[model samples]
Target: MPRTEPRVRRLAAGLPAVAAAAVYGWAHWCLAGPASPPTAVAWLGAVLLLVGACVAYGVLVGGSGSVFGGLLLALALLLTVTAADQTASRPATASCVVREVHTRLQGSLGEGAPSQKTVYRLTLDCPGGYPGELKDDRAVAAVGEEVKVAYDPRRRASPAPEAETSPWRAALCAVLLLAASTVIAGRRPGPATRPRPGFTPG
Candidate 1:
């Protein structure tokens, strides 16, 4: 019975890791192929799902309910799948001309509290003969500045020229997160310990 208990515990602990791998594969599959940005409702749904995942994990890990572990795992899987699908969509590229530039002050003005930052907001004339605006924290450009903007019109209403540089970075970030989580999942959590009475030890 004692040996069986340890084996069961290890098996239970490993299930989450297995699920995580499945999630990684599912995300890759969804994102690797042709994709498009999901609707606003879909985005909202994914956020809600992740929130549910947090709740479900809490219920499971806190020993309030055995069923929630499965729920949490499933929710996480679904969330990642949705994210991958949304991220895989192709972006529309257009040459944009900055029509106006506006600056805003940000951050604290107190001494030694970092300098006040300038945020640049630009109104632009984009492709398809529409007016749009983009904001940048570091870019300093005058009115009538010409720049190329890459944007997913469906996902974002306004396209930032600077943002159109890389879509592969998102995939790369997901891969890195998966790798880090895998490393973390492989380790067995340490057993709980009761602290010894301290002798004023720092």
Candidate 2:
């Protein structure tokens, strides 16, 4: 066997998946052009697709923490698509006041800070608006602070905060997540994963 580094091969494999994600994002824009309803199916599909990618990556990695990166990658992908989808379809914008903030562990983090960040629930006050749950990294948004929220015109109850995401950030994270997925896909299956003889995966 030509000892090919799994990392490299995984990355190579991830390129297409990343591109697919991009295509889906763009298609979302096209389909939703000129105003379109937020399809629950689309949201569910996006969630499943991203989650599937992460699971695939996790399986590829195969280790004690079998699905480490996969879960985060899944979330990152889901949120990215959701955010892009909203932005593409003329997401309804409204201002809201932060009701409260709570910390949640995500994944890796930068230097001198927690790996997780705080999530803020805001009370949206706008025509045809309802309270919503939103989150942003610690770098932005303080508890009890007023901020602008973007959400589906049809369902104002589910809001995505502007501070939670931006174009550049989304693009950057997409690429990073793809790369991480690849890296994770390259690991060997740990002792934790082993099918005994005549035993099924289940």
lDDT of model 2 at position 74: 58
Could you say which candidate leads in TM-score? 2
- lDDT by residue for model 1 over 103-200, one digit each (tens)? 89887533322357788888888877643776766564577778776565553333555454343544454444444333332332212211246734
Write down the worst ten-residue block by lDDT for model 2.
1-10
Q: How does model 2 score by TM-score? A: 0.54
Writing each residue's lDDT as its tens digit, candidate 2 over 32-108 gives 54554366655565556665665555555556433555654654565466456545533567677666566665654
> TM-scores for all candidates?
0.45, 0.54
Taking the candidates one at a time, how many backbone clashes does each contain? 0, 1
